[model samples]
Target chain A: MHGLRRVPENLSGRGDKVMEDKYDVVVVGAGPAGSTAAYSAAKNGARVLMVDRRRELGVPVQCGEAIAEDILNELGIKPDRRWAVNRTNAVKIVSPSGIEIRISEKKVTGKVGYVLNRKVFDKFLAVRAVKAGAEAMIGSYVNGLVFKNGRIGGIRGVGLDGKFEVAADVVIAADGVGSRVARWAGLNTALRFDDIETCAQFQMVGVDFESLSMLEFYLGSRISPGGYAWVFPKGDDLANVGLGVLGSRAERRPIEYLRDFVSRMPGLSKGKIVEVNVGGVPVCGPIEETVGDSLMVVGDAARQVNPLTGGGIDSAMRAGTIAGEVAAKAVEEGDTSKERLKEYERRWKEAMGKRLTRYLKAKEILLGLSDGELDKLAEVLRGVKFDRISLTDMLKVLVKANPKLLWKLRGLL
Target chain B: MEVDSSLCLRCGACVSICPVDAIEATDSYVRPNERCTDCGACRKICPVGAIK
Candidate 1:
């Protein structure tokens, strides 16, 4: 009710009457990033409007639905039973030769892991944003951006009623991997084939798992070709079976790879597919720039996904909080220029930039490994009890196990 | 560019990777506009092999 109110006909010389609204901040896309940004901005006293193309906040789910509990704690969110379907504390990594390496909580930064019901979790986050004084518009598609003297000023989009415009001091682009908002704002956000991982997933019922509270990852070229397959259990007999293949390495569609993967896995082949989700993940790490004059990009729009795991919810939420806080402060100071907004970029980089870069390098190394080498690596890691292993420690173990890998992995050391 | 609607998932992967901003995605469908350069970027990124 606070946004997109009716306006007089042809107020700006357009033939059709357009509804208009104004806010201190306008967030495109109401996913984790957008909702979190809205919540943060509003909490910091900024008049904010959050919009999403979906009529519902989290319908036709696109994520693997796994999140670390540390992120929730960091965001000060209490885990609700309605959204936290299953709690996992271990991750099982399976090699091509069927060797399994289990990583316990000690190895993970978070004490607990959760496979979320994103439909509920995402909506809950949006509702929280609204409750914190942000306005939300659903079923709205942002088609264009309003620019003033080469600086982003607002957004133009179609809502359920009709064409609408929302002028804002700052616009946060949290529009996911397929985002055009940043590009429209003069940022070259185009992703290369090598930087993207085309993914396919199915929410399945009646699948079998050794541990309902364990997340499974399968690694091998034959399985996913430069990416990996995952099974995140939502319940004892249900799971999200998915796989991602690097676009540059893919010979067939990701769906075909997913089908083949599901068909071959004894535990998954018997399951019934309840939902199909597919999308492209930007595994290129964070882009060169995420902030422009009056514009800030968060979430997948800014390529904030982890290169090695293809996980983004954590990064998105963290960046969203920072962007929201910065946007609000910048607006309060009456300076939403790129220089003022650079604080958001600096803070987020300080938080996760080095880790992302290291992961990207690790991903490149993993892509160069043959299935046999992966098996050997897994063999060396199998049954090893790790109190706490950082990336450097993991690399050291690998180097010790397979001295041949020393030269290839010395860069990481 | 042509989309085989039967296989298209409306996931917008093609829209994100297009350097030309040629793709448009609605809730029900996704299509390539005249700005398309036939670079096959969309086809390569399509998860279901829907683009032609």
Candidate 2:
């Protein structure tokens, strides 16, 4: 039991553990957020280390595999040849009545995003981090934090063969939704039932499509209450179709809703499911704050995913970059305490936090709307034709029934 | 089968996000089982991914 401080398994006498490794920073988890954070910090002259409990990084890939192109540019990371399944120029919004509208008009600047190959994509990001001089330790399970003076010191974890301890000046909690790192560091992240989106997804192989270059989003209460269903083409006649319902209203299993949705839809139901994947996305605004002494949180851990659209790859990458930079800056100033690290919270909020707050409020208002109201809103928008309907203007009309929403609608419009 | 008590801040993020509700908090740890679909939602939504 070397290096294992607090043995979690009820195994007898597991506390007598010890391995010695050290770094300027240690990041747990090897998903997009973690890899990016590790890469950024290591590139900035920090002795960084990253770990993942899984034997492999990208196996059993669990994401919708949708990512924005612009985000890739900001990170100076290019999508490798093996990571792209298909490219799309537009995203079609389909109403409950089956009305369809294409939101992109041009070629380069159109609604552009990628349907990725997660196996390759996940590995690609981590490899970049390694290339930047960060050490990657796979199959290492981080069991707890090592603390000193009530400040975060490092992580205590185990591998397939042995246990180890890695001390660091800071820890970036890019560990994802069930992140224990943030809580252990003394930050609060409890979520309400209504704030979560329980999701179910299926990878279908035999689906024939009218169009393969565009992603389709279906909006209707009969299908997904307080959420929407999506069809993202993954090529080779395959597509990833899924839906998310508010956790509080999720009475039945997510698969049941997904099955009903695909079977009823004309184009989607024709295919057979080759793979089934289920997950959840935190569609709320950021936590009250995501920084504490000697620690910071990023990606889903920070609750930066868009509540309305449930898209997070772009935002998570953005958050990872911020966390990495702030952690490095904190080290430079020799202030690992939470008070000086508040800049991360402030900078993140100023950059993307404001929009997330608005999006969360908008989602609450949108979820409360009735099916008839949605149909009416869709109809009104159809009546008011334009090359592209301004989303803010359209939302204003949709939220007219709620005065509180109206009051909050000033700067948004 | 093992949960870091220090990591489990009792945020209930796992309880709320688990598709099958397999995660339940005892006085000390959050427990799950074969009933869990391994959707990884709890893992993903976990502010710390502490479920591992």
Candidate 3:
């Protein structure tokens, strides 16, 4: 009676005791995307509710925890010392032939990055949403959607309280890869095995020499098939060593590749393993649809990720912010129709569309290259200075340096 | 790629990966349309191994 609001306890119509299950906006999945959307929506005066099935927020980190500095700035997330584990400036791209090419962070845009303590960074985002008047509940499993007049109306699931359905003016699905929520809502959110990178990472301590000042990448089909291996130092001799393999090309598990990868790296081989993380990252181009009726899907659910690099945190945040703003405005206009939610798709496309399209084209070409071709690619990129090292930029450089080797890829350009 | 239909969670991973937009998913089944080139990209990502 103290903290509970009364409504229908159940549709069975027993006694009058019930809980209020209504909000202006409901966001499923309390990761970066969900929290950002909740924050944006609440900031714009939409009473928001965020839910996640995780018993604790940000635990069991699933990513490499690397974020470009500009991505953080794009989302207006300030550089906070607390969540940032390492301020990385140097980066090296190693070829199949053991050729190492150092790329300056300032020269290659987005190369200037940080290795985050995601356990803290993710929670910080959810806290920001709560501070903005958005309420969040963990341990809530949203099993299905509530449809009204063929439009998304709310969510139904078992939570700490029990099985219940909550109503909302809009439902924002920010669930990550393998999003059943998106599927249940009649949306296509699947990644072809070829378009997905099954990644595994290990946090290892006692890493040998060299400053935690650089992020490194190793490329070769032998090492990771269609994906690559990385070493992201978290400072204090603790580093995340990981490898991702194209799901289709993976003969064994991605973890096997990571284990083999770790043993090869002198800095990682002997280090003591502390934490291991495994997950599926979608690398497909943007989905054909992102919104329908009163529903707006943001982040990975919409495939708002870089097709070339398996990174989505920044894109997720950006999409979430836009979804929140658009949802709030739609609510104020009393239009939660499909047409109204289309504005969210429009804004995010304007912001991140071109880059993603270019990346997708580039990814197709990269997948077609062999390890020997990759070595040649490394050779051509040695002396090049990258003001902004994007897939488009890389493709241009490759075509220019090795005209014959990559002439077939010119059509994409 | 063959659509088992039974194992298909209808997640659409295959439908989205069709290079030629060959696959479509209904509430019950996922199948390749006339446009299918049989590139097999969709079968690779099916979580349930519904497609082969």
Candidate 4:
């Protein structure tokens, strides 16, 4: 029989050097990846510390704020008061020639995604992480990594008052697109300018609109060369109008393109701009390696954004959950080595990786096509009913529209 | 206003979207004036969430 664990006499002692707190895990960047990692880790009975560089967890909102409802349910997170904007039921894709193809709302998983209030939604996720027993830190800028025997130990960051270090068995890198943590840890995540897309968006009010229920997407080189524009309805006569342009074409600039498009639209021209936002989306392939020696990366930091849509939230959450389980297991086994952490890459690749690879390939092929070719393709597609269109059906249409392009797509298709 | 040079793409997105012409593209950055309405247009238009 084991005696009751003796209580240390230093419950309130002055000689005590305040034993440095050590968490099971330390998550950097309190975005979707970090927050999800923290929540999951804490739920597994591991201590977690979540940090964000901003003074506030989420504000000065960014992101399209669109996430699939199926993903939300899978993560066990419900739509709360804070981030709920509206449930999206349908999507309209307008071709360069102004031909529109509407995809109706058919809930395959009995779920429809919501257009969120990002700042609020982000904070809500952070709050959930905290509720799950993770310590939350804001306005904390991570200065560098802590290492032990050539393996990652934890992180060091500066808060409002003083600098401090958090020690943990594992570190989760969720720092967004420009994150350097993984690179610093010797995980290569180099990205090229062409792989990036510079995007701009605005929250506008007082605009007269029809059918507030649908999300409209405009595609064509004329509107946005190597990119497209979107108008996401935010209710109350408000909308988030945005554009994403290839970063290589930095000369045109996203806002300039947005301005030119908005000026031409009578429905949008009347709206008064209440907010402006800008960000860059990585429209390239995923990072080659997502884990190494007690470390894992998720979300935009890992270059996991959709190559075509530039949407990352849902994927990030999924990746984060996977990262959490792997990191926690690594900690429990006392082996945070690269071999053990390789599970993260294996898990994500097996699950979402295949789909992402397919989409990335499609994006590359589509980007190589000429404006005339795209217009012709769009014209052909306008005749087909979207209800009957599957991936193969769409490919058939493309093949019929341009037989010459078929040979080039042999490898990709 | 000071643009953190690290994140500024200097793509002139702000200058292009400025309805009041309060922002201009300088050699290194987008310079804003007292005329800046803080309408948050530049903030929304930035692709990297660079503007506040």
Name the top lDDT candidate. Answer: 1
Residue A280 of model 2 has an lDDT of: 60
Off by over 4 Å in 2: A1-20, A383-390, A393-411, B1-52
- Mark the regions of model 1 whose C-alpha exceeds 4 Å error after superposition: A1-20, A106-110, A388-390
lDDT ranking of the models: 1, 3, 4, 2
Kindly report the root-mean-square deviation of model 1 from the true structure over all alpha carbons.
4.0
Q: Which model scores highest in TM-score?
A: 1
TM-score, candidate number 3: 0.84
The window of 10 residues in a row where model 1 chain A has the poorest summed lDDT is A6-15
Candidate scoring better on lDDT of 3 and 4:
3
Give the Å shift of residue A384 in candidate 2.
5.7
Flag regions of model 4 displaced more than 4 Å: A1-20, A107-111, A388-393, A400-405, A408-413, B1-52
Candidate 4, residues A1-413, lDDT tens digits: the string is: 00011112111111012223487888888888888988888777776777776655555455667777778889877887568787777677788777777665555633466788888888788777777767776666776799878778888866654677878898999977656577669876655557777777888898765557677888888788788888888886988988888866555667788998888889999899998777667778688789887889999888888887888888888998888888887888888888898988999888788778877877888788777766777777777765432445577777877788688566546
Candidate 1 vs candidate 4, lDDT winner = 1
* Each candidate's DockQ: 0.80, 0.10, 0.11, 0.09
- What's the distance in Å from true for residue A169, model 4? 1.0
C-alpha RMSD of each candidate structure in angstroms = 4.0, 7.6, 7.1, 8.3
* lDDT values, one for every candidate: 0.87, 0.71, 0.77, 0.73
A1-413 per-residue lDDT for model 2 (tens digits) = 11122222212222223223777778887788888888887777676777776656765555678876779877777666589778876667778777766655365445457899887887788877777767777667777799877767899866655778888998988877656677667676655667777677889978866577777888887788778888999996799998887766765655678899999877788888987665567787778778888788888877778888888778887877777777877787788788887887888888788788778877876787777766666765554433332467566654664455465455555
State the displacement of the C-alpha of residue A132, model 1, in Å, after optimal TM-score superposition: 0.5
